[model samples]
Target: MWWFLICLAALIGGYFIYGSFIERIFGINEKRATPAYTQQDGVDYVPLPTSKVYLVQLLNIAGVGPIFGPIMGALYGPAALLWIVIGSIFAGAVHDYFSGMLSIRNNGASVPSITGKYLGNSPRHFMNVFAIILLVLVGVVFVSAPAGMLTNLINEQTSLHLGTGAMVVIIFAYYILATIVPVDKIIGRLYPVFGALLIFMSVGLMTAISFSGEHTIMPGFQFGDMFSNLNPHDMPLWPALFITIACGAISGFHATQSPLMARCMENEKNGRFVFYGAMIGEGIIALIWCTISLSFFDSVDGLADAVSHGGPGNVVYTSSFGLLGVFGGILAFLGVVILPITSGDTAFRSSRLILAEYFNLEQKTLKSRLMMAMPLFVIGGILTQVDFGIIWRYFGFANQSTAVIMLWTASAYLIRHQKLHWITSIPALFMTTVCISFILSSQTLGFGLPMQISTILGFIGSVAVLAYVIKVAGKHKNLSHSDKATDNLTRIT
Candidate 1:
């Protein structure tokens, strides 16, 4: 319990100390005019108060990933807790900080566009396809997850037998409206309310856990215990846990989502609050879910059995219902229906912006916005029919893969200016190895290769990528005017 409290404090302190350090390294310039004003489309590039943008950014990236991802990761035991704390402080927050700040630096460019500018055209094109597919997967997964929870909630409460398909349609309708409308219309208005629910849900669940008479499966924390692989399914701890317990840790999905809030930010100084602070908030949420999942189930095996039986959604619903009672049921609705819906809308919204950038179409017109959003909905509509569990697995791989790209991109940005590139460079290399090993391990996201061979290959791949990143950074390129405007970039508030 003491260790858990310490980890919680670490996450909060990371925001004040580490977040500020990253902000300084990036050289935030409050003097530069942001896209919200310079290119205020009132649609996508509309400016908002920093507090409002923080809430919007929190909901946009929070979704259900912080909940479901960590819940699934709890099957691996307390290691998930450590990952949520450590990864968020060192990697996740850094990834998100750069994702938004770099976009702000580049006229609110999307992830692919910024990556292309720093890493060259190959990655830009790869990220174009990669980010789009990941966003669609996130959209489809969020759509189906909430729809499933809603389906169960409705069936249990009323005699209504609404299927997941019906709920998906309702969600899709909302997504289309959220995607095509101006930034202030649907998302901006409701995000603060939704973000509040997300935090309250976690805190409510934590209070329930603390007062429960049930025997918790949680073991006393030891320094070495966090790294032990306790997964019942024999999954490797190195890459699989890192990949499974995403979003709360370090997610590439956040990178794509960051640019959405980037365009809405009123100043560069707000980047730390809206981007890095939101990730730390998610880490807290993920930690709560992971802790309660372990406590409520009584054993890691029991949690795994529950997961194997009905998936993460079932685990979330059961724990919420058992611990919090009738009110728990209501929060379950919010967890399944509201949280994911908030993220789903922004997922599609970001996709619309990215597709517009792909086609070089100005998003100033309603017609152009619709043109970009239509295809994402069609693809999401088709994919929602394909099980949420499978979609989530694929999304995790793509999510982390995208994070690696964003990390490397940030490293390139820092290295190009010769301003302490190691902060991002180290994480980029570590995640690059994780991604490499994950895709080749033949276990979860990889091919049918032996673990030893997969690990060796991952090492080789990381080295090659490291060499390439250094070479790219070494090119005699000029930092953008925004990167040089304020060298101190110091503001505590």
Candidate 2:
């Protein structure tokens, strides 16, 4: 209980501190003139109200990762709680806040654009390519995992014969409706109602599971046991942790949310509320999932059994509605249906933005529309045949690598602008070191990559980008001068 309280405090404090820093470094004055980036008037680039922006940002960033990552992390037992708390604060929150703020300052550009600005054109292209590939990969797994869970849940609870194809259709329909509809008319009304119902369902299910007196099977592995029992084929702990943290860490999805939401900032001051606030909310979601997993299942085998034997759905359903009886179960079903909608809309919108930017197309054109939907449809089709577990792992690794590159870009920006505070740079350096080490170790261990081929390629990609960033940092001589002038004015005032 005390640990939980401590974790909560850390989450809250970290957001406030890091979010403030991001706002300050980016010169995100509410009074600053809006940059003349051609924003589309419709769903793609239409300026949203601040509240809607926050809500959308929250929903987009919060996905299946928070739910599943914590469960898997709990395999390490209570100690994993420490990682969730600390790593989320230092690694995840910081990555998100700065990434969003940087994108905002760069005229709603994506991370790759921001990278191109600070790095070089070639590196930016590479980063963008990596980001898009990762986005597609992660997007598919993201849709599939939840679909799998939803399928299992429906089968366990009701007589509904929801196949993966049917679920995909439902998701696509929801995305179409949400994207084309006015924000005020749909998301604004539906989110609060749905969010409340979800909370109720989660609480009800958890309470029921608690009172059911079903003892959680505690797996017998000690803290040190995992070290000795490390499968020769498995990657080491640090790398696994790094990759696993990608969803919570920095994700390319943030690139989409930041710029789009930045346009609605009633005041630049609101950046904190939107960027960091969303992350803290996500952390709470993750914590809730962790509690659910830790309290319900005592053993790894128990969890595996729940997932393997069609019990994953029962676990979600039973835990969700079993507390309130039949009505609660019905509500749980509705919540499952809604959860994917939030993420699916995000993916659709993000793909649209990436394509619009890639080809320099007007956002509303038929070409942009077809371009956006095509990738999603293609990815969805591929996901139906692939092993999602393996795909998700690869996505996770790719996400972390992209995040590290973004962090490097941000650090370079700060240094060039003479705002390179130790608070930010220290964590940035630490995360970068951890990520690089993890990627190397993953190759060494028989995790993937035929004989370090992938590792070598990733290394080359990273170095080329780093060298470009260094060159850009050196070349941006005027940035330091401008920052100094601003400081001088501040002191005079």
Top candidate when judged by lDDT against the true structure: 1
Which segments of model 2 are wrong by more than 4 Å? 25-27, 33-40, 176-189, 192-236, 299-301, 304-315, 322-324, 329-337, 421-427, 433-439, 443-471, 480-493
lDDT for 445 in candidate 1 is 53
What are the C-alpha RMSDs, in order, of all predicted structures?
A: 2.7, 5.0
The list of candidate 1 runs beyond 4 A from truth reads 215-224, 443-445, 477-493
Cα TM-score of candidate 1: 0.95
Tens digits of per-residue lDDT for model 1, 170-287: 8899889888888888778888877887777778878777867774436544567677877888777877888888888999989999999889888887888899999999999888
Please give the lDDT score for candidate 2.
0.60
lDDT on C-alpha atoms for all candidate structures: 0.84, 0.60
Worst 10 residues of 2 by lDDT: 484-493
